[model samples]
Target: MHERTHKVNAGSSKPRRPAAAGRSRRAAGFTVLELLIVITIIAILATMFAPRLYGNERREFR
Candidate 1:
């Protein structure tokens, strides 16, 4: 692949910025509802398994 270089001015120069109407990459990530749903599912699973794991404190009589 050929290398394409952007030659900048020797000094005292700044790159141009995109106009206001341009689409940027900053508009991404999870929404609050999605996060809440994931958290709720995890909580439910933990609750279901916690009792089985911790409820084994049986005391057998001699």
Candidate 2:
């Protein structure tokens, strides 16, 4: 029987950058303009559908 041994060289490994330092703030998430656009779209959709939803409920009660 033969046994083999492996050695790791920690010093040769590349150093990692800090999490915050590795990425820019803009790249991490949506911008203010993008968020506002999405919120506006959602509000518009809610306004468009809200009346129909409530109208159906009122008729079911009568």
Candidate 3:
């Protein structure tokens, strides 16, 4: 039986594949500012449009 051989160049530079989403090199968890900004945006939109939504007691929960 004969075995096939394959060779790759060592001198050439190659681009690396991108990481898949939800898989992070760093530890998970959002920064304070980032989370605050997101929360603030949601709050602003909710406050501005909450009245228009039906049911005054409880319209929706994010």
lDDT of 2 at 35: 97
lDDT computed for candidate 2: 0.87
List TM-scores for all candidates, in order: 0.46, 0.58, 0.42
* Local accuracy of candidate 3 as per-residue lDDT tens digits, 1-62: 89998566587566444676436844587778998999999999999888777566564542
Candidate 2 residue lDDT tens string, 1-62: 89998666687775556687846766889888999999999999999999999999999999
In model 3, the clashing pairs are none
lDDT of candidate 3 vs native? Answer: 0.74
Tens-place lDDT digits, model 1, residues 7-37: 6767748876657534454346766899999
Each prediction's Cα lDDT score? 0.75, 0.87, 0.74
Best by TM-score: 2
Error of 1 at 46 (Å): 0.9
TM-score of 1: 0.46
Cα deviation at 52, candidate 2, in Å, is 0.7
- What does each candidate score in C-alpha RMSD? 11.7, 10.5, 8.9
List candidate 3 segments past 4 Å from native: 1-27, 55-62
